[model samples]
Target: MTHAHAARPPRVAAGPAAREPAPGALPAWLAVLWAAALVATLAFAAVGGVHHAAVGVVTGAAFMALGAGMVVLLAPSDRVFVTRLFVGGFLARYVAALFITGAVMIAGLPGLEGGKDYLHWEASGWAVAEAWRSGSPTVHLTDKDPGYYYLVGAVFALTGRVAVAPLLLNGLFGAGAAVVAFFLALQVYDRRRAAVAGYLAAFLPTLLVWSGMVYKDVVLSFFVVACASAAIAISRQVSARSVCALGASLVPLFMIRPDTGVTIVGSAALLVGLTGRRRGSKLAALAVAGGVLLLFLAVLQGAGLGGKMDLLARFPNPLTSVAVARESWANEVGAGSSGLTRYLYGRNLLLAPHLLLAAMVLPFVLPLPGTTGGMMSIGTFLMPGQILWLLLLPGLLAGMAGAVRERAAAGIFLAGLVLAMALGVALAGYFSNPRYLVQGVPLMLVLSAAGIGYLRQRLLLYVSMLLCSVVVFCLYALARGS
Candidate 1:
């Protein structure tokens, strides 16, 4: 509704820039995503049994109803494509979640015992839910990501006592994230790019796979994106409504991922403070943004949360992280493919700041998976998503230049987001966990969408650099005997 900071062509139109896309705009790639999930589900059914999958589908459908119901009630009347994208996003995650747990368990994939963090969250939430239902105190569960377990527990209190309930909710949240992403992209980019971003946000293999499983990251990601969307709105208009929306979305996030919550708050404040058209109005908006930031920090600190803010000003400092300089280096390095379990294994900071370099090259990665003997001996259920990441790589690089540019207010906020996430990853060394990348996926997709057209121009150059990065990194690993 606000065009104050909107980017546009020289030519103008009276209608909304993000008009309805062509018929069948949701596209067949979404179908391919579902098909991949289906195959994985089938694999689980054949290997494990149908019982787990049946429960998953039933449970997923229930969660889908709740999440989708809210969307339908609140969604703008004119955006049919948003609704379609929502369905595609929800179904992809729901179907993927249906049997993914069993598939991981039986196949002995990476993080097999706990299916990474999903089973941990599910089991813990189930216990917490039972404890709450029985009116007992002291539901002993993980302190890490306590928000996820409690939320999952709350859902179980109202639904069937299904173990797969969290997965279903994950599917729903994943869809919510896509919808949020659609609006975020529309902030500065055109309608067509927004649509591409919407679908990519929904069906990108990493996003769908992570959300399909029961874990904190996907849930946290939805809230993070929601906060960012609200922040962008605030940056453009500084409305009472937008500020409240940001707060509503941000409170739950302190426990989900404190670093991200704090970063967005600070970033939003910076944007509001900097982008005022009139000094008088800008001062008022800055006061509001600043007031919220100070109040939130005080409240969150008092609640024994936001400890991540203490780490905020330290190494991999968000203030200087991923400036255009590093982005240019990333454009040259092209080395996000390898999970940085031991990047710079034996090297010192003089040669390369491993995590910092890893941080700059954003897409996402996984620890090279095999039998623990060699990288060649591979047998994991995550192949599809990793393969998908490879395919998305070029678009990611192509989009790099856009973020680093001096862009609109909405665009600057987005660039700040990616920079903050890169810093978060560097400091946390959450190298092996793809979940850590959840908050950045929409930006990556939006960037990818924006860059897709220009990719052919440097197709050969990027591919060769990527191959070189891989080969050189592998040789380094061999030399170190890792």
Candidate 2:
């Protein structure tokens, strides 16, 4: 017999409240967050020894440009609040980039003592930009993901080699991600709850820090979330807008991170098939989804990964093969986090077999390792969200439970993306570096946001427990130091 589902709540009629939030909420939030980011950017420039007088000017101008784009993408939704979300989220990331720049350049950040990929990308990008400007031969990097460098070079060329310009572009994408989170949450939940999720997407530490960095974090995450969101919309209705959105999102996504792109597309294909209204519509939607996959595979082959893909297929178990590869790569991350990784994965095969179960629970436990900050590493910069993650874990669980009870497809779609990425990271034993987990942070924040409404009294209880945990951790750190 089919199980009973909880009755869904009554939908409210579209009104001014739904169309526009409290008049100045977004604007106020944007003003404060942008000011913070600007202050930090200038401080970082001065402290980090940048001689460019235009740094502050450039930062402000970029925020303005990003704000303009945000309005175009989100304000058109009849929700001026969404445009505000773009500002909050973009500035959060903007502040994050400057913090990282300062830490790496000034504080002798213990975390990234070994290597700083963003600095490398910035330097290389500047070189490429200069070559292009002077009519010199182009520089091509063969060792790494050259696509990101080329993008950085293009931005630097246009802006005359301004530092962190690519990061500003990434912040723009991060802002778009925030807007997408708002709309998706609104679709699945309600306007009020969606607004909460949207703002959470803006202020969450991991979301800000990773998106703020000049690396591939925000761009990679945006496409994945955008693809997943489009996939969910397709599940609701196979429309030209949703189909085109899915294709546009999944194409660049594949070029950026192939596995995550597959997870998103695969999830979409499954979702569309399961939820389509009719046999004809289901077939058509599935066909379009398959077309995107085929196009991505062709691109992969052109990029010289066809043989690797075929070899991956030849594996008796692809997950195991991928895991071994990731484990090897994780070793490169260094010895400090090796203990943490082993503690999570273990020598025994206990964690890997329970992929779905483990993926759902693993992200919460990540904050445990470096909470004391005794051994700083690259993970430390991303670790600002650790305690926040702890604080939100209960709500995340509560939100997931609520979604299950209500049978919310959007929640399932979001939960799917988050868990899929976590599972892949877990299987690969890539626990040492938390950046791999950034792909899921925005969606996790959405879940936590929804859970906030569900936790009426328990919220205070959770906060008290969090404070207790912090006190205990502090005591332990003091004891060790003494």
Candidate 3:
């Protein structure tokens, strides 16, 4: 029943073997310069009250320097440099993404209000601390989940209250998500394409904006990517170390947001049930894990611990009171067509079908305005925008089609997509925000890369370069404004 005795498939050609180190690799001194530039840019933003223009100049200079260092490090001939660059690039991207998002949130975008919900969370965390100081055995501050708040509170406690911590943390999560996405893509595609996708996901504008905020979406994104990466590793019959890594990734899901945790656990159980050679044993192990998780949750709730456990309660009834509360909040926030009352009652009913369609299509077509400085305003409905966006749909379809011809990639794609969709639908209430679609970003990138790979001789190169240019421009605009 084990993989050791499982049916073996025909072996494909192994990937490239290790090459000898080249002497002319990027010098250590150059790497140090790149790191110093990045560190200085971040430190200046953290302390100095610089203008947006100045901050942008510093940020761009640092990133550009880092990118150049990466190019030198990745040079194929310099195997040692290539290895160093690959590792350094990954770490640099993670830190840079976090710093940039934190800086932007600290800078505060024009017209976009700042420091409302975040302040509230911090206050709630303070309340938790006050309760602890008293003789209270349990601390129930507010309805909001305290996991993120506690983490932020610890940072605030150490640094004497900074407004940028939440955003910075979110950015860090975004960067982590990007790194995970890159490795996941590499598993399905080649190393170069995977690296590109990872970098794009990290630096993408919409992602950057979210990273700078105090929200659970970015946190959810990190776990989602971790889950996907774990699944990919498992499918490849990778090392036991990889399996342990997958299990460890799932731990955060349980604590960050229980509903997501349940969905992930359920999906993993389902996959194991459907595919595991020792189905009974696998199911038993899953049941034990699920039971233990539920018991822990029950203890937390019974102890009157902080925050609402609505995430657990909503599982049996997906259309629960929480959904109703969210709908009410959305109406209050004027999310739909007209006034709150109208949108809540008659307008929502009228627009339900169209909204559903938009929900399905927007993720694919949206050019991620965070990347393009032009606000994702009504202008996105224009013909040029429509044409540009349509390419993603066909690109994704073509990649899936191509995967059908390549069984290994197909399995990875199907597993990842199904898990993604389940998580997406489970978190459907937040679909209005493009950042919720971050998990799918890698899949889209893979498809786009596949399309380019498939049509390398035709207009593919030109088209890919054009898209890349647009994306880079958008990122530059975002960074400049920050």
Candidate 4:
């Protein structure tokens, strides 16, 4: 349901030189940067004791030096170079993801104390693998998503009981989501903003750390971004490819997290109805919306919700469900430290706005007073990342404003998606964690990029670094005080 408004050109200026570069060609230096990132990944991996540590260190060292040398040799603003940065940023982010995954595996795996959710999911996967190997392939977990377990099982079936299966899968999916986020921004905004969105999606530490783990958050995030990206594409131009991507993206989302899928589809439909003009586009949107609803019902029934509605019966009041779940999870994960956690420990409709605010800010201001004991806290190791997010918050807001001003339909869709997901997670309660908030990270990143576009690059960089330093100092002081 898009309005027939003309798309606004972005504010960022492209330098003179090759104004009409060949399509699909990027700067060669990006490849070098990507290579460097890979080498950096190997070095990080080696530090985690994954074997070949020496080789990784040597390889990374050489690549870093070479990439550095090329940085001076290459200019920043050739048409080809500027256009290619998005792809390069996407690829290089994966290398960074490798480093994160390696570190997580090194620190948390095989009895170093990690999230219970990880243990449960991994165990379920192991069971699924065993079942598949034995020709049963049936999962008995009443409350879990069978698709995730089966996915893990399939990996085990093919590769045989590898502990790293989930880690690698998470990393790949996370990386793919980052790229898709870039493409999504490109579909709706200018290349400069798209580039910012892509790079932000790649390096968001929360995403990086989650990608390194053996959980469904990253997987869920990938599908969410995929569905959103595909939706944006189809909304703008209904094509076989866009339609296919949209349809395909829904399949996994349905399987992995039907509830989330339902919310996302519903949100998209509303946006379509509000913004779309073409009859064909509207029909296509309706088809997808209806398909997603039916699929969600099927998943629920298959998961045993149809006959008894036992899960629904447990929480007579969904708002209460949200509150209880959030509080319980905080205690379980040691996230009780935050002021927001304390404020949200009890259920009340009056707290709805507060709930949204808490959800939005928790990713940036975490490990507050009550968050001292949980495995998810990671013992304040995430503090710096939190600080970075705080620094970017203003930019994220500005970007959202820019998106709405420049591309109202897409911005509305993103806002609706984020709001709907927040409500869904709150209502569902038990499994709610900030990890689920990762679904909104790409949207925020896109907005942040737009915000960044409004300022001079050098000025923005200096301000960002300054803010970062101050945040780091505050974090250090807080840590010491604690």
Candidate 5:
């Protein structure tokens, strides 16, 4: 019998292959970094003498509560197994916000300030608040963001005009931004990488310094990141809910910075056209976005939203103005720069290598001499502890390379967002400062985290290079300071 039929292969399971377990939550090293940042910032605040110290304390408590509430609402459901991460993130960000509020309050005190720009901001913000309280038009005061003024005014009214009020509000925004960056990176990559990105977003000097200030830069940064996160969600799974989230996020952006809002939409359109899987729907999305932008611009112009400095007038024809503005700024501030900064501020495209170098490095390493004006608003040092950012550069480059290779939709969005910012900065001379690029800092952190993940195999090499970069930056800073 016959047979010696070969024993049938053990019945193969008919179900899908067993999926790999997801990565663990934020790493212990990241927790260490966050704690260090908190201690350092608090020390700085204590030594700096927190102005309105009592107010800062009260505001910090409020922000801590806000941070805790946010964790409950926004912590990712998929990471239920690592639920302690929610607690860690909320605590880290909450403490960071408290210290930041104290520092900003101390630095932003009305009489002891250093920058006219900050003074202007404070006065304008107070006036806006008063006007809102008394029901008057702030249109004549300035052509800047109404949303910021409204918010600042509301906070001032609530807190009885304490300078800490705005600082506290901004602190909350910064903390919320860290949370958003965490989830956003989680969507793009895995948990460990997400932790890296979130840690950087939460503690990065760029965000901490800018977001702690009284300026609108941090608010713009938050909205930009929010819009990017919403866009990423939509890209992963397009739905009415995602679209509405995107639209809702953009509304505040439009109110605060219309040009940036346009740039975001334009970038989003490019992203969908390049990377969207659906052929027909992609085209339709592009058309609709374009139409909406054009209509919005027309409506803004019709409503005289731009006043004398009409944004629409500069559109579709900004190069000439850009050149003029670049020349003027170079004459004003491009004196000692030797590398990309000199060339870029000089608006010299013939030195494209310098442009590339500067574009890649300036966001992290751009130095401000101690004697430089506008120290109060910008800070005594541009990105203090600047050497640390070197750790992320390799990751950023590696991530960008991998993204291009993969033809990832997230990569397209990142490229578009960066390009739009670069172009916008070039086009608007007044907006040419590095601070204007703060909006994209969250994405930059995301890319850097991706870079870390990609280079995990070459861990030693990456660490060595990172250390060398930090050493070099320190040596350079010392030499310059000396």
Candidate 6:
């Protein structure tokens, strides 16, 4: 046996350690470059002396630094803490959004010419309360949404000081939305991807500019993201706890905007059906719970708990009428098909390069400039160039397709719901703007991050990074100049 034994091959022992890039392997030179870029951006903003430009520049730089740190720290970590990433990105985004919003607020503060009247609602609410107390039966008002006013009234009733309360509340909601957005992204992707997505949502200029304003958009966006996040969590595997959260989150959606709430419910139902989890008693219980909630909302609306609820019930009809009226007004204003179409086309063309440039640089830069209302306020039908920016939707769709391919079920579901909602608004003849599409922006970034992850060539990654930097710098410069 020993003489006839076959030659034995040498056995290699397996080790605990796995091959990885050396610590500090990433180019130090790149870090230096990022630092230089941040400094240059701040310098440019300071030199330009645009209103509150220093705040913009500094806040933006801080975001960039934090984002870069996150990227560097997480790049080599094999185990990703999804929650930590989400929280960190949320904090970064919130800080950036808060700073930009403050700048806009200062610019539009009540005392300045053409400045925003932050105190308008507060003053009006007090006036109405005073009138009501004085036995004025006909305390009528044009603004029907009473949620903000009621909250303000309550504050005034308690404190006898109503200054800036409404604006503060709106700012709080906006900041809260930024936090929720981060968690929502984390629920769908790994920590790194979620961080990027959250950062994108938080830093996007449109959201920053609009969130702090006393408007419904911030509240709506918060509820929308919360509802979507909850639904996605339930779809992954319906737990009693998750179901409860989903149900609770829906309440805010209904309260803030009933039409959007309906859309969310419909999306959830579609998701549940597609998931094929119909046989269980738990599922049955969840259905009943959802039904009860809907019934309650209907009852409350009927009883006039919130007049907005009643308005919501008649939304479809009134929305159609508004659309018709808008069209008629456009026609009367000589903004008919030919004129509006030409304008839309021209604006779209003009903005195309800028938007494309923004897309490239946004991923790399921190505290990216918020989308000022200037461009988006220009009606879509009146500006072709503006309509062209809608191409971002297609880009987002492509990114979503990539998510689907990767079997990111949650991402796909959320993205689908967002697309449906956006399409509904658009088809109703409502004009589209980058701000309107901000909710979908995270999914787009997630897809882009996934794509980048798949293409792991160092040279290519660096080249892409360079391109992003250039785009961000150029866009910031242009926005400042404008």
Q: TM-score per candidate, in order?
A: 0.74, 0.76, 0.58, 0.68, 0.74, 0.53
Model 5 per-residue lDDT tens digits across residues 104-201: 55655442223566566667778877887888988976556677777777777766666556766776766666667777888878887887777677
Model 4, position 448, has a per-residue lDDT of: 69
Q: In candidate 6, what are the lDDT values of residues 352-423, reduced to their tens digit?
A: 333333343332222212332342221211233222223233334445666788766666676566555554
- Cα TM-score of candidate 5: 0.74
Best by lDDT: 2
- List model 3 lDDT by residue over 302-366, tens digit each: 22232245545444443354346345435532443344334444444543443443344445443
Name the better of 1 and 3 by TM-score.
Answer: 1
Q: Which number leads on TM-score?
A: 2
In terms of lDDT, the poorest run of 10 residues in model 6 is: 376-385
| Higher-lDDT candidate of 4 and 6 | 4
**Which parts of model 4 have CA positions greater than 4 angstroms off?**
1-114, 141-144, 279-349, 368-381, 405-407, 429-432, 455-482
Backbone atom clashes (below 3 Å) for every candidate: 0, 2, 1, 13, 0, 17
TM-score ranking from best candidate downward? 2, 5, 1, 4, 3, 6
Better of 1 and 6 by lDDT: 1
lDDT of each: 0.63, 0.64, 0.50, 0.59, 0.62, 0.47
In terms of lDDT, the poorest run of 10 residues in model 4 is: 300-309
Q: lDDT score of model 1?
A: 0.63
Worst 10 residues of 2 by lDDT: 299-308
lDDT of 5 at 245: 77
Write the number of the candidate with greater lDDT, choosing between 2 and 3: 2
Error of 2 at 361 (Å): 4.5
